[model samples]
Target: MPSVRTILALIASSVTVLGGALAEPTVALPATACTTGAPMTTAGYPIPYYAQATPSTGAFENGYQPEPRWAGQHLVGTYTFGVPSPVETGFAYAQFKCQYYCLNQSEGGSFFVRADSKVGSYCECYDDLMDPETFVNNNQTLIGAWNAICKEA
Candidate 1:
């Protein structure tokens, strides 16, 4: 009893909804981990992790990259920095954690330009354009821990 146009419109709507149903579910993106604001947590644990380099948005929480080493030691496998040279230049040390590939981009190094902002402790944020951020890491111990975690991962 439906008209031609009405039937066609119904078929099209059905196809669109059915297509979405047949498609695989999308994965959730990682969160930010900048220091300008207080560290955040999921459930109860801290979302501490690193990225290969700052993301396009340049927020730690936006996404996470894994580390690959501790201090100057090797992690496990050969890795290529996901970011560009300009991003690397800003990092103090760089590496990835071969063990924990699924855990925070494998414990890779960060591109922080501070003297106090480590993993846990709050500081400021860093940027290649604006003035230096206050959450960037500055503590040697934390940096060491970061590298070590990357190696173990």
Candidate 2:
């Protein structure tokens, strides 16, 4: 004995609930994963959406390379080590370009890197809301390292 609109509303509510249950959760990273209070600059505009180190082997999206230099082409730095939301940045860059921009570009992804002494690092690149300035402000250690290492190079 319900109105048609009421019945439609109930159906929509059920669908929403089911959808919420099926949707994947966003990636969350520890504050410690990123360096705190380190200064970072976009001095090199078009910061290479590629890693300086070799890209590890995995089910990566297209256009990723393990080595920075290959066949007279050098992949630039997509991110500085220990940056907040590197994973998120990677994901956004991938979607924006339709290609993989960093290692482990998936949510809940992890990888081993030379930096952090080869410790396993998690991918935190899911959020598209972060801007470059805000990212720099949030990740001090990463910026400091980039300035010292990448900028100097």
Candidate 3:
């Protein structure tokens, strides 16, 4: 397990950048942790968990617009195009305060990409998708584009 300080350090160093500009605001992001009792992923990966609390800013939890979805809840960014996603920086912003924070946020669970023009590493599970920065200097996690990466485990 990663220490909270380690996770926060990853967040700070791996913040995404666009044209060399930090896309994710310096707002306070929370520490996320998950554990699985049974065998986890078929690949032996970490199971996901939710840290249900509003940060300093970003979308609300479980509320979508132009559509009703997700545990009868939705967030503010769901309807608005918050950032240019799927790219390193855009994914950072989304993960930082992604309208749909996790797999449960959006029904599609992927969308809000950084525009097809841009691209970045798309990790599916573990902290790789949700937190990204652990291994990247400027990685981002795009939403609403899991069709290519999603599959039955």
TM-score per candidate, chains pooled: 0.19, 0.19, 0.19
Estimate the lDDT of model 2: 0.29
Comparing candidate 2 with candidate 3, which one achieves the higher lDDT?
3
Largest lDDT belongs to which candidate? 3
Clashes of each: 35, 10, 19
How do the residues 1-153 of candidate 3 rate in per-residue lDDT, one tens digit apiece? 999999998877666434358464677854333322232221222222222221123332332111223312323123333345334555444433332344544332322333223343222322212212112111222332221133334
Ranking by lDDT: 3, 1, 2
What TM-score number comes out for model 1? 0.19
lDDT digits (tens) for residues 1-153 of candidate 1:
999999999999999999988968899864332223222232232424433233235444322332212212422223322322333322222222221332333323333222222332222122111212312332132221221112221
Off by over 4 Å in 2: 28-74, 77-153
Which of the two candidates, 1 or 3, achieves a greater lDDT against the reference?
3
Instruction: Give the range of the ten consecutive residues with the poorest summed lDDT in model 3.
Output: 129-138
Q: What's the lDDT for candidate 1? A: 0.32
Candidate 3 positional error at 115, Å: 3.2
